[model samples]
Target chain A: MSESNTPRLPLLRFVYDGLRQMVRGRVVYWSWIGLLLAGILVGGWAYIQQLQHGLVVTNLTNQVSWGFYIANFTFLVGVAAAAVMIAIPAYIFHRQDIKNIVLMGDTMAIAAVTMAILFVVADLGRPDRIWHMIPYIGNFNFPASLLAWDVVVLNGYLLLNLGISFYIIGCHYRGCEPKLKLYFPFVVLAIFWAIGIHTVTAFLFSANVGRGFWHHAILAPRFIASAFCSGPALMILGLQIIRRVSNYPIHQSVIDHLAIIMTVALQITLFFVVAELFTEFYNETEAVMSAHYLFVGLNGHDQLVPWIWTGLGMLAIATFIGTVHPLRRNLLLLNVAAVLTVIGVWIEKGMGFIIPGFVPTPIGEIYEYMPNLNEVLISLGIWSIGLLLFTLMAKAAIPIECGALRAPGIPAGKLICRPEQQAPEYRKEPVNGESES
Target chain B: MTRYAMVIDTRLCIGCGDCVVACKNENRVPAGLNRDWVVERTSGAWPRLETEFRSERCNHCDHATCVQACPTGASHHWGDTNVVLVNPDQCTGCKACIAACPYDARYITPEGYIDKCTFCHHRVEQGLDPACVATCPTRCMHFGRLDDPRSRVAQLLRERNGETLKPETGNLPNVYYLK
Candidate 1:
């Protein structure tokens, strides 16, 4: 055998090597678990305060009914939608590189949906009365209410993904090929479910026929575009992190391909944003005037102006950075761009999304809303929970992807000692002088 | 059948906020929540600045988007009464209706049900005008049955160039404003 081509450690060995490295340094795991517990405790405390004090503790006054909770809900739903982008390439096009990463997409969906539901609970004025949304005991105004429909779809999507993911994982554990025939239907269901969540969310706003700015057929499309771009940008960043912290190998080509997807989705999103602006600005109607005032700062509320401009600026930077050469290739720059785009869209779609429509108030009063500390803390708590969920899910899933976890047909004995155990540990060591075994 | 409607002459509205107080007391609306409100606008600049006042509440829209958006069916129009009401018992307080209402007419109550102007539907059944109309010191707000051609609301619409809020939204609001 050529000396240079010495029998490289098996892929199984590479995976095991990685896991040993992670466990040996168990601080990372415990610290994350600690952080998660702290978040839940803090959040639970805040929630108790909210339950006792009512929504008054929230910054939502008579003017702005929806504050941080709704904004987070909107942002997380977009995050969930990113799964479709990954699923399209993996399942539809059957991209081999995307296959391993596909689990992250679905897993993220679970975490994102959990956060969306958390926001709903946080925003409730009477948190105890939430059960009234049930079918018979509580009047479930079906088909008509986008919110009711959202409840059904979001929960359904969550369970559907849970079932499919567990089944796939179970198959992997037992050494069997995933039953594609059984699961393909759910995949289709998930794509439509992805569209359903964001679409219903858009309809919740745009259905306001009295609010001329919201009364547009284009709102749904705008939401989808925003979701498509923001979702994948988050996924790309997540995968990049996984590759770094764990010994997982993800091709640069995959990251570049994801960037291309983000670039196109962002372009479409920007196009819709422009079109919406044009439709509102060009119209000289009174109703449209109020909306324009919120966006362009005609009334005393100039606070929204800077935020809007910042959103625009960041979006431009993200698009430019993502589309430009070498910048997109650099992991740091790419992550920054992805994160920027995600945050920009959140500000644009979260606060800018709901508040502007209420401005110039339907009756033409400018009532400015400011979120208080309680609201901010509660929001932070919810976000921490989302991250915690993502972290745990990632820990379980990364091992499977790194080939540390064995598939069917591999003998159980051999599978346990394979590269899955070594890959994470070996990667942490500097490669400068180490000999390939 | 009482087809309730309101007509307000902007020229007569002095921005007194009496209508708001009257509605609040009549409905027992909580503090910080108003069933009826008047929006004041001061436009132009310097010596030419002009202030205009508009009194608004539920339009009791003929095609109410709020009704369609309510997941619990908490929002519904009272049959043949021309009044829209929300059932607190059924409401999960999703605020879908709040976001859906263009008039900014809907509010999430402390109890978690959607709240809006009912046009004093209870008093209307007792053959009385809404508190806002009855207590309008300047008699700026006129309330009557639009279906009754002899009523003041129908006559005002026929005599004056009255406009409904957001007519282009196609909600066909019952409330009208005279400029």
Candidate 2:
């Protein structure tokens, strides 16, 4: 630290510093916002059209009612689960460097969940009637309804993350430490809740006995493993962008640490896929027939073949590129590999994951499902919104991270406090000696 | 006070899908959607194949998983009867029941409401049998009160070892199929 007698500036100068710093980062911030706005406008237009015309806008027929909406929901579950990868280390293992950065994951969780809810809304033909979901209004089926449980769990998880983010940010703004004593238990619950959202989603599909492909027993664990890869890859990509634009620099060690998690997650996902394939092909039972047919192409027309092959190809590329001696060592390549792994898993866990279960039909007929243009646009729009939300949050957060908005000693302007520090000794006093210190 | 159920004799079914078409027309079911369907499993190879058709719908299982899987209680068995119905208003279009149902009887409709054969509950309310039973050209489907010993369906069950789909799931489906 350089020794200087630079007197502390007044509140107005502090406010000016915040605005100037944001203006300097305007290129990066505005670009993200601009692209996001374009996507939302396009997506909103398509969604409005869909609402008027109904689900006919999508290629989904009765044979495939799920299509992209369910797939996106599945993908976002992985995103939500990935929040734990960061949380486990920082809160559970008490990793100090990750402590300050944990809030990023909290915000990401909120964004992921927002997208998931939006996808559900878009998937509905009559989103206006969503109020029927209100308990007792239409009828809450309770323990029998996993969807009801999903609604509860998802909303609960969202509120939990939002609460934590607000508490932490409020503390930071006020130059006080957040009261960890109160929020810690909830944080611990959020970790398990993190795992809960994905597991429940897997069970949502796995519970279908008639759909042989989805009935497999290992779906829950498979979901967790896949989420680990996709979530960390996405986070790594986000961090790389933050490092580039913001004055703050995250330790290369943090990136390397997350890379280890990506490696393990990818390996496990690959193993599960192989194991599932072996069970289907080797067993040769009528039950496994549809999965094999959809995955490897059964009766001359392999509609999903190219996409599935590409997913596997990308998986191989991700593993190889991510493992290359200098590439993993290099932040740029590591970021590239992370991007591949995320996309690869998205395809694998999205379509390759959901469609096969309905193939070969329950009685025995192969029906194909393809997403119509509107469906694609609406999905893209929701994703863009998530990115936009993350960007805005980071715009506010990155300044604090860069030390540009921080108070001289700690954070300033807010009086939030940890319980132990809430004692009279630590409370802020009047500046001109009108109040006791 | 009405209990709705169906009896299908696979031995007589010709895989014509007449019941499927009839139900759709009666229900105003959208095109490409089937509230009731016949799954034909063809055995043997090519020209020598022998096909077996099983007409399936919501069995209105005594322990219906669809009801259990519905997060919003949109799917439920009618009082003391073998009929499952969905309140469209209550459904969130989540499709959880579609996945939970082992029989593939549940379908997600264009309106995002879950749809399935309700044993023609609307018809039953009007003192009639399900349209599928009423319209079957082959007289392959029988509709009656299973609790009434005098009913043909009950007599048929006593005479034959009728089976329900995925009985092991313990859903206690009211619909019975005769081999």
Each model's C-alpha lDDT?
Answer: 0.76, 0.76
Expressed as tens digits, the lDDT of each residue in B1-179 for candidate 2 is 44445789888888888888888889999777787878787799989988888888778776777788876666777776757788777777666676667677777776767788888878888878789888877888898888888888888889988888767666778888998
Q: Candidate 1's residue-wise lDDT over A264-363, tens digit each?
A: 8888888888887787778566667656665777755676888878987898889888778667766688888899899889988888777777676666
**Ten residues in sequence with the least summed lDDT for candidate 2 chain A:** A418-427
TM of each candidate vs. truth: 0.86, 0.87
- For A273-360, candidate 2 gives per-residue lDDT tens digits of 8898888888687787666666778887588888888987787877876667566766677877888898899899898877877776
Fraction of native Cα contacts reproduced by each candidate:
0.65, 0.60
Q: After superposition, how far is residue A372 of candidate 2 from its true place, in Å?
A: 1.8
Q: Per-residue error at B125 for model 1, in Å?
A: 2.3
Models, CA RMSD each: 7.2, 8.8
- Give residue A234's error in model 1 in angstroms: 1.5
- Weakest 10 consecutive residues, lDDT, candidate 1 chain A? A413-422
Pairing residues by index, what is the TM-score of model 1? 0.86
lDDT per residue for candidate 1 within B1-179, as digits (tens), equals 45778999998999899999999899999888888878888899999999889998999988788888877777888986657888777666667777677788888777656788998888887989889999999999999888999999899989999988878777778899998
- Docking quality category of candidate 2 according to DockQ thresholds: medium
